[model samples]
Each structure stands twice: as C-alpha cells, then as structure tokens.
Target: MDLPRTFTIRESEHRIHNPFDERKLADLGAALHLKPGMRMLDLASGSGEMLCSWARDHRLTGTGVDVSTAFTAKARARAAELDVAEQVSFVHGDASGYVSSEPVDVAACIGATWIGGGVAGTIELLRRSLRPGGLMLIGEPFWRKTPPDRETVTACHMGSRDDLFALPGLVAHFGRIGYDQVEMVLADQDSWDRYAAAQWLNTRRWLDQNPEDELAAQMRAELTAAPLQHILYQREYLGWGVFVLMAR
Candidate 1:
C-alpha cells in the first residue's frame, strides 16, 4: 500500500517524485495547452503534483492513482493547499492495469512505466482511458550517450543498453508504436542534480535523527556513494523528459 520505507523516508520532502523541477513541470503543463476543465487520468502519480498543480494553473480536473500511501496523503493535502481539491483527487492504489472510469482528455504515467512493464505496454494501458484523439503523457529516461561497458550500464541502474533509447531513437520509437510526438520537455544535468542530490540531504538528516534505525546503515552507504555514482555515470549517460503524444 506504500513505497518501501527507505524510499519514502529518502524522498520525504519531495513534491514531485521524478527528476523534474517545478519550472519544468509548469512548462510541461503549459505546453499541453490544456483547456479549462479538461479531465486527466494519471497513473503512478507520485504526490499528484502534476494533477494538482495543473488543476490550479490550467483549470484541469483530474484523478491521480499511486501505490504509495504516504505520497497519496501528501497529494490530497497538496490539492487542498492549492485550492484545487474539487478539481483534482488522488487515490492510493496500484496503478498497474488501471483505467479511468470515463474517457479522459489526457492519460499519463510519469516516470513509472514499470507499472505496465514498459513504455509500449504502459501506453496500451493508458489508451484504455483516453478519449479518441486525446493526449498522452509519458515521462521517461533515455540514453544521453551510450555507456562504455556493462558496469557503466549497471551504474546507471539499467540492465543493458537496450533498456532505453537515445533521444532520436526515443522519438522514433513513439512513431513506430503508432503515436505522433507532439511535444516534449527535457531535463538537463541541473535537474538531475536537483532530483538526485536532494536525496543526500534528506538521507543525512534522517540518519542524524534516527541513527539507531535499522535502515540507517543502508541509507548511509547509499548516501556515501550515490553522488559520485550519479556524476560519473548518470549525469553523463542518462537523460529524462516528459513527452506528449497523440494517436497517429
């Protein structure tokens, strides 16, 4: 019903769960040109940031579903704080195989395609809830550059180079899957720093306060190594972006 404790604790203060900053999130929402009152269905919607913020800024109405109970609660509170509670709602449930009860203007699964196995399968799942000609949003990572070896790939947390495409290949992939890539917003190294580096502080603070906790050792080890690991592997080889698509 929730993310693993260590993960939740590590990202305890994250309002947006991915490697996207608030500015990028706003730009992505604006790029959609979503009309007022448009309905969106968001799967794996961590903390409902996209839904709630869009509800407030774009006058969007949406539902967000995620398996993380802690994040779901934060999402609800966020909706209320933004005065978008009536427009956006969040549900604490597994997003895998989820479909909206009604057709929506947008169907999204941001940074959590594993909910449906991968990009193609996740798209199929989202298609079930999208209105004809409606938009779909997928946030995913791509290869900035090919890794040098299996070790580098593993350092990037990917099983192999086949796990993702380079930027051009990723766009071509959408075409191959029968979708038109209408728009996209990419994340730079700065965004990656914000996303990954922020975890260190959170982990450090938690360790300082809960030194006796069982997970402290694990977090300490991770915090110790994650920064340089990210700089050496991910910052140079990995990239992320939110892509907008429509049925072709």
Candidate 2:
C-alpha cells in the first residue's frame, strides 16, 4: 500500500520523487509523438509529471499508478494545475500487477523495473495492457563503461556489477526480451547531476528539520557522502537512458 517510509518522506517534501526535470520529460514524451486520443498507462509514474504534461500538451488520456501516496497526490495536483484532470487519473497502488481496463496505445514502467523483478518480467507485465503495436517505454540506467571495482558500483547502490549492463548490452537486453529498439532519450552527466545532487539538498533540509529521525539520520549520512562518491564513480563511469521499444 506504500513505499518505504523514507521515500514517502522524500515525496512529501517534493524533493526527490521526480528523476527528470520538466524539459527532459517533455522531450521524452515528445519523442513518442503522442496524439490527442492516445491512451497511456504509466507504471511507477512518480509525481505523474509525464502523464500530466503529456495530457496537457498532446491531449492524451491515461492513468498513472504508483505505490507512493505522496507522489500520487502530487500527480493529481499537477493534473489539476495543468488543467488536465479530466484527461488523466492517478492511482496510489502497486504497479507490478496493474492492468488497464482498456488496451492502451502505450504502456510504461519508468525507472522502476524492479516492480516485475527485472527488465524481462516488467516488459511482460506491461505488454499485457498494451494493444498490438503499442509502444513500451522503459526508463533504465546503463553503464557508460563497466565498473572498475565493486566499491564503485556499491556507491551507486548497486549490489554487484552484474546488476547493470553497459549501454550496448542494455539495448541487446531489449532484443532478448523480444522488443526492438525504436527510440531513446539519454541522460547525460549534467542531468544525472541534477537528479542526484538535488537529493543531497533535500536530505539536508530534512535533517535540519528532523535531526532525531533514524531514517533521516542514515539518509543524511548517505546523502552527505553521495556527491563525492557519484563524482568519483557513477558520473565518471556510468550513464542512463530511457528507451522506447516496440514488440518485434
């Protein structure tokens, strides 16, 4: 019914729930060439930025679902802010087993493939709700190069090197999952900096307010140490991109 307490806290603060800034998300959505009537189902749609913006810009209709109540509220508020509340809905629930009541033109699981255990399983889950020829939008991270050491990978919160694939390998992974490469929008180091660095300030602010909270204390320590770690490891050696795939 909810994500971890730490994430809920972060979402409530409007600090780190959205990974992409508005412009990057707009670019990604534009690449999909949405039409007025197209339907979308965005799993793990944090803050519903993608859905709300697309609905406003392209006149698309959709439902966005996430486990975070804080994000769901933000998403709904965003829809209203954008004057697109009639075109989209936000549901606070687990996205892993969610299926659209009607077939959709696109189905997406962005930055949360773990919902279905991994890329392959998540693709299968999304496909069930997609109409024939519907696009699948998968937001994923790929290594810019193979991690030189376990310590480097660990800093990115990865358990092991095998948990990630290099950029080319990730594309091939889609092929292995029976999807064809269509289009992609990659995130550069600057974008990653924006995403990762912003969290530091958010966590710092939270720590200022709730110094005694255990989760905040751990996150504070982690956030404090993350920038140097990212600059040294992830920023120097890894990359991330959101890929669009079609069933082959």
Candidate 3:
C-alpha cells in the first residue's frame, strides 16, 4: 500500500513531510534530553527525518513505518546518508493497527493520526507500543483562531471547526485522556509556508517536465490556486505542533 502519487509528487523533497523544519525538530530532540540507545516507534513516519536525525545525533534507535514506498526509500537513503543506517530503519507498510513487537521508549504518530481514526484513537494506538513511563509524541493541528464560519473551516480542509480543538483545549484533552503534556514545539506561519508553498514549486517543476502526464492538469490547477488558498485559510486558521506526553 502506498500514498497517492500526488502526495509523493508534491512532497518529494520534504524530509519531515509536515509543517516542521529542521530547527524545530532539533529543538524537539533537545527538549526530550534524549539519551543514547533510546528506542522510538514512529507511525506514518514520512521520509524518516526525525528517526534518522535522532539516531545520528542522540544515538537513538528506532523503526519508522510508512505507507509510501517512495518515502520509505527516501528515508532509508537518509539514514545511510546520515551514517545511522544501523541505528534506524524504515518499513514500507501500513502504519494503522501497527503495534511494535517490543515496547519502546517513545511511541509516535506524527501528522497522520488518521491511521488510528483521530487524535484520541491514535493516542490509544501509540500507547500499546510504549513502555511504562515512555513518552508518546503526537503531531496535530489545532485551531489557531476559531474559524468564523463553515467556509473558512472547509478552506482549511477541515470537515468542521468542531473537528479541531483550540491550543489550550488540545492540551487539556491530553490530561483528560490520562496523559500529561510535558513539552511541545509549535509551527508558526513561516513553517506552514515552507510546507505548503513548497508544494506549489514541486508541482510546477513536475508540470514543466511532463506537461501531458495524466495528473498534469490537476497539478496545474493546484499550482494556480494553492498559494492563495494557503495564505487565506491554512496559514491563518490552522496551527500545528508536536507534543510530548507521558501517561499520568
């Protein structure tokens, strides 16, 4: 199983595949005070940046599972490039319902919580693979500002504003779910721009190379409209962050 070709095409260059930069990721690794030899399990682990980087820098070991064959290959290449191929590995498989064979020091479902249906279900999924006192990392979106109406919510690709909690509400949710939020690194508008805006360029470059490809027209339309849509809706109303949690 794999992600849609469109997704791979658009995010082909993204190491993290979410609205996060290297600095933010480094900040997260640092904040965790990761000691060498810790184990992590990252579900929906796009391109394996976090795992590979942490493996190299923190001397952590991890397995990353992803649904994208293309991204899985990239992740493996990244691990090799970082000289941490022995420490981290990527599996090309569905992350949904994936429980680790062994409990890990960290269990994560970053950005693609749909693997477990939603945030709460995803947390439950992650918990199954976490060792006692281990951390769970969730990367999710919250309402940066409550959308004024349905149109804005739709523009942000949300079914309804109710689908997302505000920042404070989301943190409160962790407590309600038997976890305490101990650390977080949030994405600002600039990171959103880096994530979404870069897709436009990737689409454009792809279109230039294969104007007659089956998906070219769709990509062209997206390239034309995505910038304005991102600026108008996503960059303003949606906030994203990776939160670190431990069971209470």
Count of backbone clashes, every candidate in sequence: 0, 0, 0
- Residues 147-186 of candidate 2 have per-residue lDDT tens digits of 8888888887799888989988899989987899899988
C-alpha lDDT of all candidate models, in order: 0.93, 0.84, 0.93
- Candidate 3 positional error at 7, Å: 0.8
Which stretches of model 1 miss by more than 4 angstroms?
Answer: none
Clashing pairs in 3: none
Q: Report the lDDT tens digits of candidate 1 across residue range 37-149.
A: 89999999988888998998999898999999999999999999999999988989999968899999999999999998999999999999999999999999999998989
Q: Per-residue lDDT tens digits of candidate 3, residues 1-248?
A: 88998998899778889999999999999999999999999999999999999998899999999999999999999999999999988999989978999999999998998999989999999999999999999999999999999989998988988899999999999999999999999999998899997888888888999999999888898888888889999999999999999999
Give the number of colliding residue pairs in candidate 1.
0
RMSD of each: 0.9, 1.6, 0.8
Tell me the lDDT of candidate 1.
0.93
Clash count for candidate 2 is 0
